[model samples]
Target: MPLNTRILLDNRPRGEASVSNFRIETVETPPLAEGQVLVRHHYLSLDPYMRGRMNDAKSYAEPQPLGEVMIGGTVGEVVESRHPRYAPGDQVVGMGGWQQYSVVDASQPGALRKVDTTHVPLSHYLGAVGMPGVTAWYGLVKIIDPKPGQTVTVSAASGAVGSAVGALAKARGCRVVGIAGGPDKCAYVKDELGFDDCIDYRQHRDYPSLAKALKQACPHGIDGHFENVGGMVLDAVMLRTNPFARMAVCGMIAGYDGQPLPMANPALILINRLRVEGFIVSEHMEVWPEALAELAELVGSGRFRPRETVAHGIESAPEAFLGLLKGRNFGKQLVKLV
Candidate 1:
């Protein structure tokens, strides 16, 4: 029998989860069923979407039950395999929650991709070549469907998903502007990602002024908006969209953690004749292969660059998750457990 150390949800968080909301404990590991595999966690992905899971409120995914191990996607090495398809020493990406070790049925979604790290780092699977990469590609290329010379703006521009969206839009010959919260991220979006312009939302004093700034940068008005933070930023962008513009609402990190929800600016939506759609990357799983292939080629050829913020050790998982919610992480945030 093995002892697995895992993080459990002690109490549901109201706003801004603290380490106290989680309790870490060592417990007896369960026996692997005939189709299961025992995995030792290598890296865990800490993303903004996990914050939505922490609350008991309605969401696209089920809430984390009290006393259950906190859920997350992990890349791991198979230590023992009872399943015929997987074998010992196979490196896999799967949902293993926050733990040092886990037993999975091998039937779950995200069951690893056989990877060769010599071509690209295995960590790329968690960033530019993984879920985030797929979301940006599908949303921008297929959903928004930007035409050449069209103006596209994406918020949260320096984060993993946002940066990828901006880069792909640029590759498609669109005029791209990115909105990030701080000067550092603003500079990175413009100087690194080749965005035509980057707005520092934190520097703006008011919503109207921020709207004016975005309008100034996008003299032609926006043909598309890739929304990540959905409170005032969404409202502001809604006012700036030209007729027939498309909005892909990927996330609402601004109101995550029980922050007071803002009323939607319906007037702008109605008057501008904008088409807005909300999406979950999981829903588009069938389209992943096409997205991944394009992204991999871009990344392998140095046409795409993904920034990662890694925190060492599983013990720092809570802090890493909190940092993601607070916009402290510059890109895809990960916890290295091995």
Candidate 2:
């Protein structure tokens, strides 16, 4: 039997997550049952949403069970299979978790899906062409519903989902302004991602400074907002939004450390009549096909260039994930298992 190395959630985080919250162990792979396929993970996606799962709280999803393989999206190749739909050596993407291998039953709906890696790389499926890309599409296309020549501002502008959102919004002829943490990320967001303007939020720590920057960058006022970092950043954007503007609230990484970070200006939602909606991408599966098709085409054509920050091995996942929560990652954070 082959040895399967797995990372388990050892402790639920009280505030911020640390390396001690996880444990790595090796175990023997059990025999595959009928209609089951085994996959060897090549890459594991580390996302901000995983941080919310670390806390034992009431949310959209249940807290990740203790001492179990940490849940994650993985792109891998099928190594062994008894399922009729999948064969050995087929590339697949699934919820393989923070583990080297996964045995998935083919009988379950959406348990496993085959991916074509001829034009696109396998790891891209875990980042730009996969969940994050779909997330961008759902927020920008469905919720924000941006119009041409409108101004759109995105928080955490250099992140996986935010980067995609900015690019997609720009493609639709919207004036895109990005709010990132540093000069380097801001430069990339403006120069590489083609955002009309990029704000280094580190330079504007307080609401006054941030709001002033937003006013200067978006003189026409923000028509749409793709909010990833909520807290003070949201407050700044709220003050600059045009009347009847729309906002897609995807994440609130600022409050992930158990901090009570409330909106500084909730009145804007009512007074400005802004349409703000929060969403979890997993809840909307119907749009995946349309979103993935457009994303794949854009990525394949070099139009939608999504960047990634990769950690070399599974052991680096803990530190990599922690760094991601701290905005240390440049783009999409990934752990290369192979």
Best by TM-score: 2
Candidate 1 segments whose C-alpha is farther than 4 A from its true place: 107-110
lDDT of 2 at 287: 98
Q: Each candidate: what lDDT?
A: 0.86, 0.93
Q: Which candidate gets the maximum lDDT versus the true structure?
A: 2
TM-score of 1: 0.95
TM-score computed on alpha carbons, candidate 2: 0.99
Instruction: Write candidate 1's Cα lDDT for 1-338 as tens digits.
Output: 57888898899886678888998888898888998899988888888888888889888999989999898888878888898889988888777899989898887656655565667677888888888889898789777999999999999999989989988898899999999989989988988888999999998766677888999999999999998998778777777889989999899888887787574677877788888888998988899999988888888888777788999987788888888889999878999888
Candidate 1, position 230, lDDT: 84
Clashes of each: 0, 0
Candidate 2: 10-residue stretch with minimal lDDT? 297-306
- Candidate 1 lDDT: 0.86
